[model samples]
Target: MRTLFFRSASPSPSNSPSRSTIPTSSPRHSFSDSLMEENIEMAQTLITKWDNSDVSSYTKLTSLFHDDRREAKEYLKCVRDLQSAMHHFVNSQDSSAEKLIISQNLMQSAMKRLEKEFYQILSENRENLDSETVSSRSSESRASTRSSVSDLESESEDELMVLDADQVSSIPMADLKSIADCMISAGYGKECVKIYKIIRKSIVDEGLYHLGVEKMSLSQVQKMDWNVLETKIKNWVNAVKVAVKTIFYGERLLCDHVFSSSDSIRESCFSEISKEAATTLFGFPELVAKCKKSPEKMFRTLDLYQAVADLWPEIESIFSFESTFAVRSLGVNSLIKLGEAVRGMLEDFESAIQKDQSKTPVPAGGIHPLTRYVMNYITFLTDYTEILADIFADYPLTLQTPLPEAYFGCYDVDESPISVRIAWLVLVLLCKLDGKAELYKDVALSYLFLANNLQYVVAKVRDSNLKYLLGDYWVGKHESKVQQYAGNYERMGWSKVYASLPENPTAEISSDQAKAYFKQFNAAFEEAYKKQSSWVVTDPKLRDELKVLVAKKVVPAYREFYEKHRVGLRRECGVDSLVRYAPENLNNYLSDLLYGASGGGSVSSSFSTTSSSHSRGR
Candidate 1:
């Protein structure tokens, strides 16, 4: 039988078959037992040879038992061989120098026999496991056998090292180095490593090897070839880089996939993936660069920004709050500023030019606020150069200045008085406060001054508008009706003044000044409203138009107050703060102020000559 032949060919032949040898008898489960017996016997022979420092023989014996077996025969063979080798070394006195040389020659003969058996088994195993489906399993089994051979070689190598250390401890450095180089070139890495380590330890113990290793390890030129070391380092970096990139892109794709799935399931999947990202890849610079490079594309592709908004807060607490916030907050701010500025400019220009009144006009870009935010985010990096440089090392190109994009698009606004005034305010703010110039105090002062001037302009306009509405009642109006009312109260006795008015004086006050000023303003408005009926009704169409205008104005008062509060309300009373106080009254005031003129006065024809002067005043 073929099995019997393989068993006979193996060293330390057993009364059975090898695993790779085909059985000539009827196939039966007992065949596995035969293979196991043969493998175990071969393992013992290989171990004996390995312990005796017969490396060539050890390698030969290892080849025999290295094949896949359903019964784990090959694995058992390897294990048994290691055990036998360990036992042989522990029991043998052949290690003594007087007996070592003679026994070593005998050990080599036994190893040569074992090597012949191993090669027969390995070659047969390789031939048998040559199927594609079995390739991986076959390769693994081969690797295990190779590793066992390596182990045997290591044992022989250790014996040599023990012999060398005893004999060459007093040898010159040059001889020791030559031995190292010889081992390295011979592909005896284990032997080389063991010997090198011992040599290093002995030299260090006596302090002789320091300069040599230093010259090798620390020398700038790396006297020995280091391409292997360099290749290994580069390969490691590339592998990690590839893994990181894959995860980043994969995470976004998964988020997108989950988003399109059922909402609850998607949310759960997204949350899990996001948490994983935080743990695994957050702060990886390469990923950050990729995301930043195509921020709009990145976000739009998977709505990653929105997903981050939903998930990052929870993740950030465990990761790094400041880092996450610094990136996202600046992004959000840039977007908000860009959107507001562009929208304000376009709308203001459109209104000024009556472009919206035309049949067709260009539409403003409808990119999401966050897209624009990303577009403008680089500025923040440049503006906070030191802080950013500490994190990123260099400023990104997107963040640089000089407005790479132009603002050449046309806008049509009539440049009316209101338009001119608003444009001036915007220009002032831009010139003063917008950018993060280091001149903080100067910028603050400039902003304060602009705010003060704006407040003054609004106040003068309001006063003039009120004067026109109050007619003769305000002809000699020296103070606010509230101040005037306070004076009247002082002139009268407190009790009399209190008695003359309603007990509670239920009057709405502006938020700017609570109860006292409100009562006075209420009284003034009531008086003006009562006198308003007497104004000429010449503009009947204007009255109807005013009715619609008044409604529209009051409806937006709530929104205006909200916006003003968000912006930080100015102290002076103007439409900005007025809406917060007596919204209805302010609405009425605006109506009467725009449409109702006190019957006491009208613009003379000469008023027309000064229209340009009023325009210049704006």
Candidate 2:
């Protein structure tokens, strides 16, 4: 209060940038030297402390430079100078004292700062300094660039023009030979690709071959010398490209320890290289048109194939998702051609084998040589069984055919071995017979293999029926047998097995266990029956065959049930009792009498005559 002087305290910072005339925009480097120097000093101190295992007193001591910009800048300048000196000390030839004085941490700090500045500059100026921007700058700059480029281009054209007949033919060949030697020596695949491109371009656009033919007789060369040479050169270039691309692409850098460094470097190279190659080779407007119009014709050219063949490894390596798909479409066409060739060769071989077989007789030993050969062939065929089964699993809906036709398709004895044919027929009967034929019958072939004995055949048939029935296929023809099996199954106390099936036949079944098997078999039959041409007539001839089986199974069973329980069943299921009972007792009693009296369930009721009539008679 002596002078009544006071200093106003600074307000606390708010969210918004405060307005001031203090040039708070910052000197940019007001804190720069201090910030960098302090950061590096702190980092170095921490690193030294870490290296020394001094963890007790490592709290940041960076506050001194934070508040005083002037002092901070001065300190930072000194630190930066120290950092630069350390870098120079490490890099310089004078080793003993400088090496001892400069630490790895100080060198690292300098590198970090240098790298940060470089990246910042690059990021900020990338678009401004790019090729397109540089090309379109001020008219003076553009004109100067154009003048320089034009002059170089003209010089190149003049050089091209000066090439005589001998020179044109000899130059490229000589250059290729030298490059090939260099490539073989250095194993520089990228350089090889570049050389090939130059050669190809010379042959195509520069009329190198026309010059080559100047001294030769016109008749010795093709009418269009440049075009023919271009085609050949293109093929060669493509082959090299493919090889290089495969080397770069197919081998994963991380996985292949031998090629890790090279692969990593090549991957970076390929990213930029492949984009240029794709645009040049396939994405060019003319090439795109060709692809769209007739891809097979365009890609199938020998030149293209040659190019691809040479660089298959590189092509494989560089192939991305979109690229692979495009390439494979081309490959598929090639495979089709190859397949046709292979098919022809196979037919010839098969013919020869058949002729040889016809000439030879069966051996007299315990095993015929032909029999062994046939067994081998059978085994070979069996190998495909797994493949076919896999196909069926993957594409169950593919099995669309009538049951009989499907049976024929399965057995196909005319084209298969007797054993295989027999096996197939068993499968067909097991899968499709509908269980209509009586046990131990002629059509059922109940005596064949494991198909004998009513109990055995019925069990086998029961197993088959259960599999298909739950698939939502009716198995209507085998319904009675299924019912019979159900009765037997219940009597045997197979509650779990019975429960595995739909509890009510009329009700829908839902079981995860049966889903896959059910889906396949049902799909097969549905596809078969849904065909319009299956029966070939309004009244199919097989109708009677099916009905006969049904009648044999149903009629006798119905007759026996009626004969044994007619009186009792009539009494229980009489129309008056059915109507009198209405919805409750009627359905229950009628079902019991109808199915239970037939012995699907236990029945306690028996016929009873009136007691009044007996008393009257006595």
Candidate 3:
């Protein structure tokens, strides 16, 4: 019963049964047969001195183990010797049961000292043994594992370097490893593993806290306002990358290194240390996904989903044990929830475009408010094409009853499904704007509104990431529609102006008929010019192009009519009274139109009375 309290004094008594850990022998001889009896005497010195209450020897023994690292190795060697002594005693033909009990008691004393050393090493070297340094110095045999973890880290290398900058490798990995081997071999693995789990788990938990991760419940996230919640999501994006690439990654390396001699000890220890923290880190995204479903929220949500997927390989490799399976499941479930959230928001956005109720038309057939909102919204969505590709694969926009080929164009929708969906979103906005155009009372103004809005949408696509997804072909096709809308506007708005001029201005005609022709031209020109002067073209390139086209259509023809009739129209009446405009005047008037400014003094308002009299005379 000497030294009986050694086992009871341990923080957690070992329930693991004692196992013989002596090395295997050559086929020719038993290895334990050759070990010296003197090897057992070395450990007995400290065990007997302590148990016998030899105060001076006890103080010296404690000093040798704690203050001298050189002596620490010598202590580990004594444990190994004690282990061999016990085996030899059990297998010997002439062994005393009393001697075997004394050897066993000495072995327990050595294990108690070694267990204290193990806990001391872990507690004192938190920074020196941090995951960053540990993962970098991981054993060569785990090169494949380290390589895979490095791949996850490459996803966000600059987010937070995680103490690698001023790292000092002060934790002697070899010393911890040597002590672990001695204690675990002598059936004290439970005590060694318990100390490891407690200290390292705190490091893992605290690491997450420094990285800005917290244990968020579904209710807390659900009640968070999006503005506040979105800030949290951005922080989680950086936090998760650091947690996986540094925190869990370093721990996996350190645990596998220290307990490399026992696969089960290393696996179980790492599982307990990292599982809960990892689960909470990964579960944040899923909770965020559960909270909201809005188009405005989709981009930040995709960022969360991407963080999980990018680290999934590392998560799988680090937590590969059956004991840590819940960590891997947490990561995958996050991906699934974030994906579901993205799809829901996309549908919500599509529905919002179709259900718009802004009934009032934009002033002067300019860009509608909905066009600006939807185009800006959809343009930004194109930034997440790759993640959206995975999401949209399952929730395809079903074109059950397709619009006419003219509305969208003949481009193939199958080349990329993502492109098709974005194209469809733009089409829905165009359709919504088409409904808005109808609110304008003037048919010409309706075409002008469509032209102005379509030009805005095309310009948005060409300038942003949307250009890559929608392609130059899509851009070209819509650009032509913008021209087509402008053409329709010009044809309807100026048909009366074209009608007032003679088909053949140089053909000989009576002075009275020529006077009437000049009279009719001024009235048609003034009214159309006055009305169209208030319309707008929002895009600069389109605006300049429309001004040029109207000049080409009107300028030369009006110039020809004036040159042919000058003498006859002056003889018919005062020429200035009938010809209110020259060829130069026509160009000037067209320039002043379509800028959203109301009527300036008309160049030809004097001709309106003559035009009214002519209307009655006709």
Candidate 4:
């Protein structure tokens, strides 16, 4: 007797094995038994061949069933022949329980063999497809190498080849998707997670490529035009957008097919991609610093901040948790950097002013130029403070609470609250103004300059919205300071004038002695009046206080002198020359003298000058 075996219907010459020959007629039991044994053995042999074969070859063989008509017909013929052989044995009179069991085992073995072969074909195709992709990429890389050879003639060929190989080995999206599909179809869904890792790595690489950090050093970036840097940053952000979209699409596909129940896996994959995107986006601050060579160019901070702020909505949509966290982190960091930069700028400006202070003298008639510049800078900071407050409005309470302490590095002494750090900066500037005022040669003039500037500062604070930052109490304190300066001016300015007065007279004096005393007093009063008459007092209340202070000091002393010396002074000079000024006239002169000619006011009528003429004999 001979044995029969099954074979693939459309076998390829390279992959298909030679079929065994069927047996001729023999004794009934032996033929049936031998046939059944051959069938079972044939099924096992086919299964073993499939298990041992490479997937590429198996896939090629399996593909023939769909592509080649003859192969499909041959495959169906093999199945039909096996079934017919089994039926033939079962129908026979000699078909006993033992024979039936052998037949049943043969059919089960054949089904198992077919199932195993089917999956093997899919696996083999996946590997072959990946291999082909790699080969094509290698060819492209080689072509690139050849193109670059002339330019890179001095470079090592081995180095160039290594670089090209690395570039080619990076998996493309299309190839990744194909492998993932094969894995999913073969019920090896967990294997598709590898595709997400590849995608996330590619996205990160893409982000770095767009960032171009190695292409330009920070110094080089600093020298770049702001517009050029802005364009580069916009391009980087656009590239990030593309990377985000690509990752989203890839993850969506993977999650739909492979990671449906593996949410942790999905989250892990997206988290990595989100971090890469954030890293790329956050690099913008370095670029902003580079573009901003000075804090005077603080608009760069604003522009960079605005650029990132605009993208936050999109980032949130794409990477909910990861991107929200990144944006908030960037915001906090940007706020800190902005504060430091602004602080540094103000400090530098202060130092520059201080350095120039001794070298530059104050003008005779106006505010110092540095004073004007610093005041203008204060105005800018006033607006900038509002911007900062608005920016951190949504920030954590801890960040918002100690913002001034962090920026100004000052404890909240009750006199200078932390919330009033801007006000403190202004106060510091005013102190600088005070230092400039001390450079004047004249003591009274120094007080006058201080009075002008201090009053200006007080008026600005009280009149403008800056009062809110500096506070009502700060303004009041400065206003009182201005009054103190005015009072100092009065005391210093009139000391010489008061010193010329005669001491209190205990006895009558000669006409000539009285003549000398009245003459010296008149001369000193006239000179003091001439010198101080042109000085300015800007604030009305300060002007009135100064006039009253001088009057109280001068009027009573002059009144006593006139009463004591009038009898002899009239005998020495004629009655008209007895007193150059009456007590009332001196009081009126004191009021009118120090205020500029423009300052107009009325003196009290109650104080009278006692004018005496020489009688025939007293």
lDDT of 3 by residue, 1-618 (tens): 233222122222343335546443222223343343566777787445434233434443453333554455566677788788888878877464876888887887777667766776777678778887776663553444434333433333244234342223422455577778888888889999999899999999998889888898999999997668888988999998888888898999888878999999999999989988888888888898888576667678888887887788898998899999888888888888899888888777788778766666777888776666677667767777887888777676677886455554536334466877888888888887787788889998899889988999988988998877766777888889889999999889888888888998778888778778888889988899889888887777777788788778777777888888877667544777878898887877887777885322211222223223323322
TM-score of 3: 0.82
Top of the candidates by lDDT: 3
Candidates 1 and 2 compared by TM-score, better number: 2
Question: Model 1 — which ten-residue stretch has the worst lDDT?
Answer: 358-367
Residue-by-residue lDDT tens digits, candidate 1, 233-257? 2333343333223332333332232
Clashing pairs in model 3, backbone N/Cα/C closer than 3 A: none
Candidate 1 Cα misplacement greater than 4 A, ranges: 1-67, 70-241, 244-429, 432-618
Q: What TM-score, computed on C-alpha atoms, does each candidate reach? A: 0.19, 0.21, 0.82, 0.44
Question: Each candidate: what lDDT?
Answer: 0.31, 0.31, 0.74, 0.52
Q: State the lDDT at 609 in candidate 4.
A: 9
> Which candidate tops TM-score?
3
| Candidate 2 lDDT tens digits, 415-485 | 22322232333333343222322232322121111111122333332344222212222223234443453
Q: Each candidate: RMSD to true structure?
A: 27.1, 31.5, 12.8, 20.4
lDDT of 2: 0.31
Tell me the lDDT of model 2 at 388.
Answer: 26
* Residue pairs clashing, model 4: 2-23, 9-74, 9-75, 55-124
273-333 per-residue lDDT for model 4 (tens digits): 4455555556556555534434344444544455455555654555555424664576457
What local lDDT does model 4 show for residue 604? 16
Angstrom error of the Cα, residue 538, model 3: value is: 1.4
lDDT (C-alpha) at residue 243 in model 2:
29
